[model samples]
Target: MRKIGGLLLCCFLLNGLNGQHQVKTRKELQREVIRCINESAQQYKVMMQRLDAARFPVTWYAKEDKLVTSGSEPWVGGFYPGALLYLFEYTKDSALYKEALQKLNVLAKEQYNKTTHDLGFMMYCSFGNANRLAPKPEYKTILINSARSLASRFNEKVGCIRSWDSDPGRFMVIIDNMMNLELLFEATRMTGDSSFYRIAVAHANTTMRHHFRPDYSSYHLVIYNPANGSVLKKQTVQGAADSSAWARGQAWGLYGYTMAYRETRDPKYLEQARHIARFLLQHLRLPADKIPYWDFDAPGIPDAPRDVSAGAVICSALLELATYTPLKESKGYMKAAEKMLQSLCSPAYRATIGGNGGFLLKHGVGNYPRKADIDVPLIYADYYYTEALQRYRKLGMKR
Candidate 1:
C-alpha cells in the first residue's frame, strides 16, 4: 500500500509539471505584449531626455554601462529616430512624436549622401516612417532627394548599386544592399518614375544570379569585375567564414526579397523569400528560442552569442511574409515568428526599465569579426523589435 501511494504521488507531480508547459491563452499573450511595449516606452522616454542634440545613440556598451553615440554618417544613425516613430505609433505619446521630429531634423542632411549604399537605411527608415505617419511636403522632397542620391550609385554594367567605395577596381555588393531597394520602390510609386523601379529590379535580379549558393544561403559580400559584370570573388567580411551563414545577412535577404515580391509581385522573388525562410527555419543549429547565433556556422554552437537584431529582423519579415504566402506556408512562418517574439520579450533579451542604456533589446552582435558592437544593444535591434511588436499586434487584431 505504501509503495502504491508513492507511485501515485510521483505520477501526479509529473502531470502537474506537464500542465505548466501549456501554451498561453490569447488574453495572456496580449497582456504580456502590452506590458513589453509600455516598458519600452518608459525606457526610451528616459533615453531621449539624456541624449544630446548633435549625437545619435547607436548601441549600448554593456560592460562599461554606457550609451554609444554616432555622427550623422554612421549607417545606423537613422534607426534611433525610426524606433521612436514606431514607439509613438504604438503609445500615441505626444512627447515621443516631438522627439522623433527633432531627431529627424538632425538626420535630414543625409538625404544628399551618395558615398555609401546605406542611404536607404539612413534616410528611408527615419523619413519614410515619418512620411507614413504624417505626410508633409518637406518629407516628400527629402525622400525624393534621398532616392536620387541612392540612384546615383547604380552601375548599369554591374546591374547593382555600389555597396562600398573600397577597392575601386572591384564592384563590391553585400547582402545588406537588398534592404535598400524599398527606397527605390517607394520613390517609383511617389514620383511616377519607372527608372527607380527598373534599377531596383535589375539589382535584385543580379543579386539573385550571383549571391546565393545552391543551398539558398547567401554570401555576405560578392566582388565583381566592374568592367564586364564577371564575378571576381565570393567572400564574407562579418560572417564566420566565406562559406558560413551570417545570421543578420540571412535576415536581410529574407526581408529584402519579401519586400521585393510585394513591390513587383514577381513569382521568383516570392520563391526566393520562401527558400530563405526554409533555410533559416530548418537550419540545424538554430536555437530553440529562435534568436540565432551571430553566425549559423560560428563555432561553439549553443555557447555562441545570439544576435537579437537578426531575430528581430526575421520576426518582422516573417510576419509580413505570412500575409503573402498561402495558408499552409503562412502557418509555419507565423508560428516561428510568434515564438521569436515571445523569446525576445522575455527578460533575457528584453531590457528591464532603466536598463541596457535604455535600449529595448540586448545581445546584438554587429560585425563579430571586426570586433565591433558585440553583445550590445543596437539601435537597429530596437527599431525592428518595435516594428515586429506592431506587426504582431495588427496580426492579432485581424484574428
Candidate 2:
C-alpha cells in the first residue's frame, strides 16, 4: 500500500513535468512493463509444454494455426532460450530456468561451428545471460569459444567478418554483422585477449565506412571482392529494392552501434548510433504509432504491414542510447522509446494472452522480399521486447 501510494505520487509529479506531450509517466509505464513480463512468463510456460529437447520455438502462423519449429542451427535459435533466461531472471521461475538450460545444452556445440556470423545472437544471448545470472565457468568457456568461431570468419583484406559463403569471389557482409561484435567483445573481456577486440573494432570501422548512406540509413548488404577487398556491389536481399531501407536492418545498425559504444566507449560509434536514430525517427514514413513498416521505402505507404520486431529492437536501442546522451537529448530518446513501448504493448501489436501460439508480439516481417514469415509472431521480437522492458524498468525513474 505504501509502495502504491509512493508510485502514485511519482506519477502525478511526472505528469506535471510532461504535460505538454501527454506522455505516460514512469510509474505508469513500470506497471505496464510488470504486467507484460508476468503475462509473457505464463504464455512461454505454455509454449514450453509443447516443445521437445531437439526443437526450439521460432514463429507462429495464426492463419494456419501452427507453431513453427526449428533446429538449433538456425540463426534465430538462441532467442527462445535467451528470452527464457530473461523471464527467469525476473520471475525466478525454476521452470523457465530449466527450459533455458536445456536449450543452451543444445546450443552449446554451435560455439565451434565457425560457419556463420551470428554466433553473437546464438551464443551470447543465451550463455551470456546465463553467465550473468548464474556465473558458471562452463558458460564462460562456451562464450569464449563462440567468439573465437565468429572471429575465424574475419577476413584481413576486407576488414570485416564474412557473413555468407555463397560465392567464392565475393565477401559478403551485412549490416546485421554489427550485432555479432558483442560476442567478440565479451570474449576479449573474458580471456584478456586483444585479438577479439581488434577484430570487432575492425569490423565496426569497415561497416561504418561502406554500409551507410549520406542520410545514415543503412544498406542491407555490401559485397566485396575477396581478393582485393574492393567493393563489388551494394544490394538488399530482404528489403523492397536494392536501394531501399529495410526496417529491421536499420534497427540492427542502431542497436549494434549503440552496443559498440557501450563496449568500447568510442565517440564515433555513439555519434553513428545517434545519426541512425535520428534518421529513423525523423523519416516521413515512420508511423504515428511509432511502429515502422516492414521496409521504410516499401510501396503502398500508410497501408504497409507494420514490423513489431523492428519496433522492439529500436525501442531497446533507444533506451540504451538515451543513457549516453545529455539530459535533454536523453529525455527525448526516452520519450520516443516510451511511445514505441506503449504501441507494442497495445492490442494491435501484442498477442492476446493465450493466442498467437503463445508468442508475445504480432506482425513481424521476416525476409519480406522472399515472402517468408510475413505478418506473423517472431521469437526475436519477444526476446527484445522483454529486454527493452527490463532496460526501461531499470532506467525509467532516474529523472
TM-score of each: 0.94, 0.94
Candidate 1 lDDT, tens digit per residue, 52-71?
Answer: 98788988786677878988
Model 2, C-alpha of 251: deviation from truth (Å): 0.3
Q: What would you estimate as the lDDT of candidate 2? A: 0.89
lDDT of each: 0.88, 0.89
lDDT of candidate 2 over 246-308, digit per residue (tens): 999999999999999999999999999999999999999887668898999998665567788
Which residue runs of candidate 1 sit more than 4 Å off their true CA positions?
1-22
RMSD of each: 7.2, 7.9
For candidate 1, the C-alpha RMSD (Å) to the true structure equals: 7.2
Score residue 398 of candidate 1 by CA lDDT.
89
Q: Which candidate gets the maximum lDDT versus the true structure?
A: 2
Q: Which residue ranges in model 2 land beyond 4 Å of their true spot?
A: 1-22, 397-399
Question: Scored by Cα lDDT, where does model 1 land?
Answer: 0.88
